[model samples]
Target: MPPHARSRIESDLPGDQAAGKPAPQQPAWPDPGLLDEVQRELLNRPALVPAEESAHLADLMAAVARREAVALQGGDCAELFEDAAPSPVHRKLEQLYDLSATLREQLGMPVVTMGRMAGQYAKPRSSDWEHTPGGEVLAVYRGDAVNAAEADAAARVPDARRLLAAHDCAAATLKVIRESWQGRADGNRVFAAHELLLLPYELPQVRADPEPYASSLHFGWIGDRTREPDGAHVALAASVRNPVGVKVGPSTTAADLVRLARILNPERRPGRLTFIARMGADRIDPLLPPLVEAVSATGIPVAWISDPMHGNTTKTGRGRKTRSVQAILDELTAFVRILRAHGAWPGGLHLEMTPEPVTECVARSADARTAALNQYRSPCDPRLNAEQAADVVDAFVALLRAA
Candidate 1:
């Protein structure tokens, strides 16, 4: 690690919880020496993003806090290394642009466009092991950054070498995004973001050219599973100057949220913090209001974005992971109404989506069926298709307009 980076990691944020809990969902790597070598190599490599771009993203997020703009951030639930090709990258970018255009026209505010790309290869899994169909027990597929999604014992071992590959893939994807998006107006350009999981990969990528920030991604966030106030993930976010967010789930208490806010944004800065509420449709009315009320009372400027996808996730009869479009829309509607009622800006929407026509999601209102088992492709969570995504944005805008 760089000399300047030590203080950021060692220092504890105010009101930090007991450091007893191990950082959840971290892969149990077998070789500590190999991991150290990987980290050293990463320290010598060029950062994937610049400090200035991250600062600019912070400014945009601040606008969302002020109700001067909105943010539309979505992409693959877990990016595949093979999908780093120009075709897949370009398709995703085009989809984001299409969504942003609609949001800008209806909301009459500049929509900050961000994609879960470049470094979204790692994920926090609910379990460390999964049972295969043949009754074989193996490690769960965390993400491409940790282990292979294939259900094999050998493939499940955590490998430090994959971190290097992830970095390379991130660089390639960024290259494609910049080349394809060159000459586009900044207002329509997309930014790269991902959950800052996988400490081995994330720790080495932190840089302090003058201000500390995660140079591996334009925007990075702490997942619901890893947002412990004293956990390494929160420490990483608190130590950086880039705009950071935390996934707010139903179980999170208002007091815990307040402590998180103080730890992350001690200065009460606007763009420095965002709380993405992933409360389910049924829980939003009862669960979200208190969080909003408590956080807002602190006078800390935070952008409250709704993540309608994660909270609404369900499984089909065949055991395939899927989500209901109606449920997603319902949660989004409740999210907006609740935020506005509290005199707060809805701020943005965070979704897991793809530009393809996959049937991983069902739309009961439209008579859409569950994803065909043979055609489903995502390695992790199901994602909304382009058509469903349009429906979500359209519904959200209609409600926003009325409100």
Candidate 2:
């Protein structure tokens, strides 16, 4: 990384004020020298998105916060290196745009669409290692950016070389997004986003045109695992000028949520910050209203969106992780109700979905155990297929019209 960027990160910034300083879920790369070399190489590479485009997305997000627009952000849960080709990228964009179009028509408001592509190559695993069905124990698969998803020991080893491959894949995916985004009559467009995990990959991509901003992707978010108010990840997000979101789970205290809003968006820029609520269907009623009330009382223009996927995850009869489409909708309904009751805008939806017909996610009324086992393909978490995702959009439309 450049000296200026490194200094900015190491030095105390406004976001460095919170208590917990631990940065969890990072890969323990074997070779430190090789990792430094990779960071240097990435520092010399071009940014995936420009600073101006990030500003524009922030503007759109502000509109969402004001209830003048709605946003739809979705894509694969963990992007694979092999799926970086044009066909996969195009299909994903097609799915996202179609959903956004439906939102625009139904709500009579512009929809800002963001795809969890380009830089979504890293993930946060619950455990450092796992046991395979064959009784072989190995390091858990973090993401394509860290190690291979295969169960073999050699494939699970963290390698610095994969960092460069991830950057290349992201750039290629961005190229496809740009090329396909041209000549749209409806004037709809999609932006690139990913979890701002892996500081090794993120810090090097930080560029200072005048002030530092994460130029790796148009939008980056802090996952629930890494959103420590005083930790390195929060510092990284706070250091940048890009529009950022944080996953707000059930355990998040109202005071902490307010503090995070103040820390991440000190200036109270309308669209600069978003709080994505992932409270489970059973938890949203009691947990969310107080959070919304507290944050709203602060008068910060933070967008409130629903991430119904993460908190609703359940294990099937065979013990495979899956999400129920009906449970997701249930959470969405409660999310909208809580936000509206607190006088907060139900600004958008954040989802994990794919164009592929993966049966990893099934409707609640279906033979869930049997249905979730067929054609399951995600390397990490279950994602809604095209039809299942459309069902979500239809439900959101109903919620809005009734509102």
Candidate 3:
């Protein structure tokens, strides 16, 4: 948009302060200056993006809450540091833009396209340490932000300096996204996001047209692993003005959901709080209804988006992490239908998607194996490629309209 428009949106975001819940498990970085320098550098650098973009997202999220528009959040399952280069970034941007087009053309409404990249350099894994089959233990591959994605002992250990590297990589990736979308008149704005992990890197990582990034990620979220009511993630998110979301897994309770809504969006700001429900296909049918009803009763309206990726992850015969395209679709179908029954908008869909032809799960996947998956490269999780993503869009639109 215009400079004036950007300034107006930038004006709405809150200045940095204590947007955190309280202390969770804050790790002791080997060196504190590394953290300090990274934070300072982030402040000096161009806002990873303009604040107006985030404000626009908040508005878009509101429309979703009202069922007037649907959001399409997708990107790399795990953003490799090497992929921070312009080429892969450009391709990913194209995939996102194309995904947005498919939704707008068929869904017949505005679509919010938030990429799970830029600042999404951190991840929450099952273990803080991992070992090879031969029993050589490693500290575990946290993310490019903390350690290398490789399994070597040297690569697995957290390096304090990697925090700065993460900022540089995020800056580079954000540069690509901004340039790609620069001067475009399209109202469909794409926002950058990542799991709001409690690591030192995530704390200072943010972007603005011009502002400090204590919690500047355009669309920051708390993953299922860290959604505890008393956890630091919830506390930290509560304090930020940027559009914030929380992912609810199959085990999340209705009471917990209501309490979380109150904590995150006490003012009941439109699009201020988004609840991304990731109940698997079977669980979505039975588990989602009461949660929706409970939240509705509380009168704290949050954009209800479905994250069909996480809950649907499966292991192949060769121990590959994969997901079925059909499982994702089935859960999403149930998500919209159940929400409609509750007299609420499904709001949007969250996906781990890429432009590359990786086999997350597709037809004939019953026989799918790791060897069968072409270009299978994600080190963290499985994702839908362009073809599979297109398949999803087609099915999702038809299902939404039928609703």
> Which candidate gets the maximum TM-score versus the true structure?
2
Model 1 scores worst on lDDT over the 10 consecutive residues at 1-10
lDDT of 3 at 264: 88
Please name the candidate that would achieve the greatest lDDT relative to the true structure.
Answer: 2
Query: The CA-based lDDT of model 1 is what?
Result: 0.85
Question: Is candidate 2 or 3 superior in lDDT?
Answer: 2
Instruction: Report the lDDT of model 1 for residue 399.
Output: 84
State residue 303's C-alpha deviation in candidate 3, in Å: 0.7
Write down the lDDT of every candidate, Cα atoms only: 0.85, 0.86, 0.75
For candidate 1, lDDT tens digit of each residue in 226-322? 8878777887788888899999998999998999999999998888898999988888899999999999899998998999999887776666778
Which sections of candidate 2 miss by over 4 Å?
1-21, 185-187, 365-372
Identify the superior model by lDDT, candidate 1 or candidate 2.
Answer: 2
Give the distance in Å from residue 97's predicted Cα in candidate 1 to where it truly belongs: 0.8
Segments in model 1 whose C-alpha atoms lie over 4 Å from true places: 1-21, 365-373
Question: Which has the higher lDDT value, candidate number 1 or candidate number 3?
Answer: 1
The better candidate by TM-score, 1 or 3, is 1
Question: Which pairs, if any, clash in model 1?
Answer: 359-371
